[model samples]
Target chain A: MNTKTFETENQLIRAAQAGDQQALRELVEQYSDTVYKFAFKVCRSEDDAEDTLQDAFLNILKALKTFNHRSNFSTWVYRIVSNSCLMKWRKEKRERWESFERLDNPEERIQDSYTHWPDSPAEALLSNELQEKMDEAILDLPPIYRLAFVMKDLEGLKMEQVAQALEISLPAAKARLRRARLFLRDRLEPYVQS
Target chain B: MADELKERILNICSELGEDIDSADCKKLRQHVASCQDSSAFVDSVKKTISLYKAYGPNIDHDTSSRLLGKLGLD
Candidate 1:
C-alpha cells in the first residue's frame, strides 16, 4: 500500500522536477498536511509551525530544480521543514534570551500533576484525556528528542529516513527515538497501569 | 535479567510492524510474545504510537492557497 503511494509520489516528483507547474502544485497540496502536522508537533506552536510550513515550501520550490533525486522527495521535504523549524527555534530562543536576562529553572518545567484514571485501564488509555496528556508529554520532550519521536513514531518515517532528515547517524537517531519512547512510556505508565 | 530483555525487546519492537523487516524484528516479536512483561511493554508502546498516529492536524485549505499565492505559484 505505502510502496505504491511512494512510487506515485516519485512519479509526480519527476514531473515537477521537469518544470510541470501543475505537478508542483499537486505535490505541495499532497504534502501540506504532512509538513504542517510535523511542524506543529515539533515547533509546539501553530504560528511557528505555519511559518515553518511557508518557509519549507518556498525553499522546496527554489530547490526543486536542483533536486538530485538521490533521496526520497518526502525525506527531502522533511529535511527542509526540520531545518526551518530549527532556525525558527533558534531565532526565537535568541530573542527570548535578549529580552529576558535569566532562563527559568528546568526543574520548574516538569509536569507532575497527574489526573485520575477511570476504572478500566483500557477505557482510560483510549480516553481523550489520556490523548491530551500524551500530547502534552510529547511537547514537553527536549527539542531533539521531540523531533526524533515525531518523525519516527508520529510521522511514520523509517529510522533511516529520520536520520537522513535530521542529518544524524542511524545509531544516533535510534538512540534519540529510544530515549523519547522511554520517557513517554514512563510518563504514561500510571495511566496505562490504572 | 527481564528488565534488560524488556528494554531490548522494546527498542526492536518500536520499529516492528512498520518499515522494519529484518530477522532481528521477527526474533524480537517472538521473544516479546513469550515474555509477559515484554508483551505488556510492547502493547503499551503500540498504544502510545497509535494515539500519535490518530492525531491528524490538517492544514486549512485557505492556508495552502495563501501560501501558494505568496510564493507566486498559484
Candidate 2:
C-alpha cells in the first residue's frame, strides 16, 4: 500500500509502453491478480481463471504497443481481461450448448456448474446443503442474468464498468441486473424469510 | 403477510443495496437477522460471496510466486 509502490508501478507502465521487457514483465506480475479474480468471478473455476489470467497478460503484452495512455490502466487492462473471459465463455458454450435452447427468461439454461468451483474445496465445505442449494440457485439464473449478478453483485464492478466490459448498453446492463435480482428472489423464497 | 415480508425484503435490499456485505446491510443487520428465514437467506447470500472468496483467483497466492519464478522475479 505504499505510495512508492504505486509510483514505481506508474513509471514501469510508461517504460513498458515503450517496449521495455522487464517493465512489461513487472506489470504482468502486478496486475495479474486483478485479471485472474475478474475471470474467476465470471468463469467460477480455478483452471479457467488461471487460463484467462495467462491469456490476458499475454494479450496485453501483444497489444502493448497500441496501449492508449488516455485511459486508466486498470480500465484498459480490464477490457482485455473481460474480452478474454467472454471469448473463453463463448468457447465453452459452443462446446456444450450447440443443441441448447436459448430461453427468453434467461433462467432456463443456467449452468449447474456455476455454483461450485471444482478446484475450491472450502467452497465445498462451507455447509454442504447450503452450497448445493446455492449452486442450484445460480444455475437457475439465465446467462445474462448470471453474468450481471456475478459482475455487479459479486465482483463489485459498477454498472458502467460492467457495461463496458460486457460491451453492452448501460440500460441493458441495468435490465439484466433487475432480472438477476428478481430471479434470485424467486429461487431464494424457500430458503430465506427475513 | 407474505407480500409485506417480500416488500420488506426488497426494501431492505434497496435500502441496503446489493453487495452481500454492504455497509447498509451490515449496519441494519436485516438481511442476516436472527430468524427462521433469515438464516437461510444469509446462507444463500454467503454462498455467493464465498464463491468469490474461495474460488476467486486472488485466493491462489501461489500464483504470484509461481508467476515470479516464471518471469525470473524469484
Candidate 3:
C-alpha cells in the first residue's frame, strides 16, 4: 500500500470494525491488489492466487469483528493471506522440505557465482524477456525464501512485519531475505552481464 | 580479512534503502569505491532489487469484481 492509502487504511479498519459495510468495501478495494499480488508471487499460479485471494478476503470479513486493532490491519490481512497461501501450497505439495534446510544454513553461499552489473539495469529490466526471467527466478526460489523476499522486497513490508506475517523471528526473516537475494543474484547473473 | 570485508559489503547491500548513511555504511561505501569486486557485488544486488521493484502486478478487474460479488460487496 502507498503512504496515502496506508494513512486511510487505519481509519477504514476502525470503521469497518465498527460495522460500517462501506468502510469494509473500501478496505477490500484498497488491499485487493496487494493481497492478490502477494498470493500470485508466492503461489506462482493465477488460479491458486485467485482462490487464495477470495478465501483471504472472505476470512478477513469473518474475522474483522474479532480484530482488536492491536496490530496494523495490513499486517493482520497479510497474516491471513500468508496462511492461506501456505495452506494452498501444502495441499498442492508445493512446499518443499528442503526450503527449511536452506533457511537453516545461511552460511552456505551460492556457489560458482560471477556477476557484472549492467550499466543500465533499469532499462534492461524493461525488456519482456528479462522480466520473465526475473519472474521465473522468483518462482524457483524455495518457499521460505520466496515468501521472505516477496513480503520484504516486492510487497514493501518491513522486516518486523515480514517476520510477523511469516511467523518467524526477525533474524530468521533477515536470513531468509539475504539468502533469497543471493540465490536470485546467482540465477540472474547471466542476464545482468549480458 | 577479505572474507569479512565481503560479508560486510553483502550485509550492506541487504540493508540498502534502510540505513545507507550509517558509519559502517560510509566505510563500506569507501571500501566499495576502492575495490572492484565489492563495487560489482553492491551494484548487482541493487540492480536485482530494482528489477524486482519495477515488476509491479495489478489484480485484474474481473477478479476483483468476482471476489467482491462472492462477498456480497458488489
TM-score of chain B of each: 0.63, 0.40, 0.64
Model 3 interface CAPRI class: acceptable
Q: Alpha-carbon error at B1 in model 1, in Å?
A: 9.6
lDDT of 3 by residue, A1-194 (tens): 44333366667788888877787788889889988888876765677678999989988889988878888778888988877777766676564444544434433333221122233655453665675566566666777788888888778788889889888887778778877777777667766542
lDDT of 2 by residue, A130-182 (tens): 55556565545545556767778776777677677667887677666655664
Tens digits of lDDT, candidate 3, B1-74: 25455456656645653322446666777866877776666566667776776643478899999999988989
Clash number for every model? Answer: 0, 2, 0
Q: What is the TM-score of each candidate against the true structure?
A: 0.73, 0.65, 0.76
True contacts kept of each: 0.39, 0.26, 0.44
Question: For model 3, which pairs clash?
Answer: none
Best by lDDT, which number?
3
| Segments of candidate 2 deviating more than 4 angstroms | A1-9, A94-125, A139-144, B1-62, B65-74
Ranking by lDDT: 3, 1, 2
Computed on C-alpha atoms, the DockQ of candidate 2 is 0.24
What digit string (tens of lDDT, one per residue) describes model 2 on residues B1-74? 35355445534654455554667866656534666665454455554444434554364668766655654545
Q: List the candidate 3 regions with Cα displacement exceeding 4 Å.
A: A1-11, A95-129, B1-8, B12-26
Off by over 4 Å in 1: A1-20, A93-107, A110-128, B1-6, B12-26, B32-34
Candidate 1 lDDT over residue span A6-120, tens digit each: 3676677888888887777778888888888888766655666678889988888888887788888788888888877777667654332231112222232334323222245
* Clash pairs, model 2 backbone: A106-A142, A193-B37
True contacts kept of 1: 0.39
